[model samples]
Target: MNLRKATLTDYGVPPDDIPALQSHFRHLDENDKYNLLQVSIKYAPGIETQIYDSIVNCIGYRTMERFRDMPVSENDFYGYKRKTMAEYYHLAKLTGRL
Candidate 1:
């Protein structure tokens, strides 16, 4: 699902921690990056549960929208991945979080 920016900073990660976070993010391979995104978003203001469900393979997209939980709609949505590596990098550069 395409939502707002979800960089470390966008998730309310503090500025002091961002450099280290980005440095950590930089070294991760694809699988690790995917895992990192999952863990990283766990306590974000919103979108946490959705990301968690994707990781656990527990809930379906329709369930979230049907229950009026996540703000996603079927039209603008993809299957599971909430954010892409490209997206993360883009937002990081945009916000100077990279």
Candidate 2:
């Protein structure tokens, strides 16, 4: 909520306008998602504890289904696994995980 300390405010978003920001974030690509995660952590530190954790848990479960349903090889599966883990790590860090 501290605009001066928040990276999001650099994008001209006010703290009171987070819902709209979140809606916009939902439509971004993977690279954009990762970038938003970083920006979100900088701007809305509490979101990791509040929203990011829940989203990571949900996406982690769904990634399994996606990987299985895909035609990728074991190596590719590992890549996806790593990416998922990285995403979780960022989320956890943002959320203040141990």
The candidate that achieves the highest TM-score relative to the unseen native structure:
1
Compared with the true structure, what per-residue lDDT tens digits does model 2 show for residues 1-98?
Answer: 32223243343445565454445434555655565456446533433322333243334324554543434443443333333334444453455431
Candidate 1 per-residue C-alpha lDDT over 1-98 given as tens digits, one digit per residue, 9 for 90 to 100: 23443443454556676565546554655655565465436433355556545434445567767765676554323322334333454555565645
Clashes of each: 0, 0
For model 1, the superposed segments whose C-alpha errors exceed 4 Å read: 1-45, 75-98
Clashing pairs in 1: none
The global Cα lDDT (0 to 1) of model 2 is 0.42
RMSD of 2: 14.3
* C-alpha positional error of residue 3 in candidate 1 after TM-score superposition, expressed in Å: 8.4
Q: Which candidate is the best by lDDT?
A: 1
lDDT of 1: 0.49
